[model samples]
Target: MFYRLMKMIVAPMLKIFFRPWVEGMENIPAEGPAIIASNHLSFSDSFFLPALMKRRVTFIAKSEYFTGTGVKGKLTAAFFKGVGQLPVDRSGVRGAGEAAISSGIEVIKRGELFGVYPEGTRSPDGKLYRGKVGGVARIALATGAPVIPVAMIDTEKLQPPGQVKPNFGVRPGIRIGAPLDFSRYHGMENDRFILRSVTDEVMYEIMRLSGQEYVDIYATAAKRQIQEAKKQAKQSGAEKQP
Candidate 1:
């Protein structure tokens, strides 16, 4: 009920304001369980992808989004919940990855579309990063669900991190790739090499669709490098300021 209400107002506004164009939407199955595996570029990637889809896509968000304190926290929780997002504890728990995969399997068994970011986190740079296999690959092999590669083109420009409002009148592009089936690797989810092979293939398709440069390193590592570089620059500047 709340999801529908928020969509009623938010969807139209996004279409008019952002003017995103979608291609290969026919690849999306009309019904049944499937996973929409996409590259994480910006915060709005979640919002824009589902707004244009005919079916509801649920993505696992951080539990912090749902556990805020105060009136502002309540509103934040309501908005994320209304958008069909489920929360998982991403606080470095040993079972965090397992919990995410379990949640995805349940959603797939229910014959609903489950969205996942194979990279595990947003790209610190625009380049497509290596995928983390524990969530998407494990769930697909476990449930026999097809994986669809989705590309959120240039969404980073629309609403880069720390920007409260999106830049209007910018047209973002969404491309959906053909569904990938990994039934060949069924029952091999526990095999580390098989999981890496499956995850690499999915990231390749996303890179093709998004036309972004592929990076072999994980996004998290790249973020750390960027932060360290910034810190050094700041310290250097402080030394020079006599």
Candidate 2:
């Protein structure tokens, strides 16, 4: 109920303001379970994809969004819950992956759209990153759901990292590709090789659609490297100050 209400109220405002466009709407099945495997560009990727889609697409959000400690935290949690996002605890790497897989399987079992980012985290530099093999492939094989590759274009520009308000005059778009069927590897979700292959194929499709430069490293690792570089730069600046 809340999801529908929010969609009704918020979706149109987003559409008019952002002028977001989508291609390949017919690629989305009119009904039935499917995994929406998309490239993670910006935080707004979550908001725009769902608002523009006709059906409710549930994504696994980080648990921190739901467990904040202040008034803003409570409102954030409420908004996410109201929008029907499932929260997965990301403290433990292994546990978080398993929990996301389990949640995805349940969503697919109910014959609904389960959205996932195979890259596992938002791209640090707007480039497509190598996908982790655990979440999307494992769930798709486990539930026999087709994977739909979605590309969120120019979303990072709309609201870049650390920006509180979205900048106008930038038009975003979603490009949905035909669903990639993986029934040939049914019940082989445990095969690590198969998982990697499936994930890579999905990433390749996203790269093609979004036209993003492909990076073979995981997004998490890229973020870590970026943070380390920033720390080193700060240290060097302090040394020069003395």
Candidate 3:
């Protein structure tokens, strides 16, 4: 009820303001379970993708979004909950991965659309990063669900990292590729090699759709490198100031 209400209020406003376009509406199945494996370009990627879809799509969100202490935190938690996002604690790597996969499997079992950012985190520089191996592949293989690759274009420009407000006049879009069938690898979810192969295949399709430069390193690693470089540059500037 809340999901529908939010969409009713928010979707039209987004369409009017942003004029966001979509390229592959038919690629989305009319019904049944599927894993929406998308390239995470911006925080708005979550909003734009679901707004355009006919069916509800649920994504695994960080627990922090739900655990805020003040009034702002309460609203944030309510909004995410209303939108059908599941919260997974990301403090422990293995535990978080397993929890996400488990949540996805349950969604798939209920014959709903389960969205996942195969890149694991938003790209640090608007380039496609190599996908992490566990969650998407494990869920797809476990549930025999088709993996759909979606590319969110120009969203980073709309709201880049750390920006509180979105920039207008930038038209964002979604490019959906055909469903990838990993049915042949069904029951091999535990095999690490199979997981990597499946994940790479999905990431390749996302790259093709988004036309973004592909980086082989993980997005998290890229973000760390960027932060370290900024820290070093700041130190060098301080030294020069003295």
Q: Report lDDT (CA) for all predictions.
A: 0.89, 0.91, 0.92
Residues 1-242 of candidate 3 have per-residue lDDT tens digits of 87887688778888999999999989999999999999998888877888778889999999998898888688667767767999999999899988899999999999999999998999999999999989899999999999999999999999999885899979999999999999999999999999999999999999999999999999999999999999999999999995
Listed per candidate, the RMSD to the true structure in angstroms reads: 1.5, 1.5, 1.4
lDDT of 2 by residue, 1-242 (tens): 77887688768888889999999999999999999999988888988998788888999999899898788788677767767899987889899889889999999999999999999888989999999988999998998999999999999999887775888988999999999999999999999999999999999999999999999999999999999999999999999994
Pairs clashing within candidate 1: none
Which numbered prediction scores highest in TM-score against the true structure? 3
Cα lDDT tens digits for candidate 1, 1-242: 86897689877888888888999999999999999999998988877887778889988999998999998678668867887888999777657878888889999999999999999898887889999868888888888899999999999888886676788756898999999999988888898898899899999999999999998999999999999999999999999998
- Superposed model 3: Cα runs more than 4 Å off: 69-75
For model 3 the TM-score comes to 0.96
- Candidate 3 overall Cα lDDT vs. reference? 0.92
Q: What is the TM-score of each candidate against the true structure?
A: 0.95, 0.95, 0.96
Candidate 2 vs candidate 3: the TM-score winner is: 3
Question: For each candidate, how many residue pairs have backbone atoms clashing (under 3 Å)?
Answer: 0, 0, 0
Q: What is the lDDT of residue 73 in candidate 1?
A: 78
Q: Model 2 misses residue 196 by how many Å?
A: 0.3
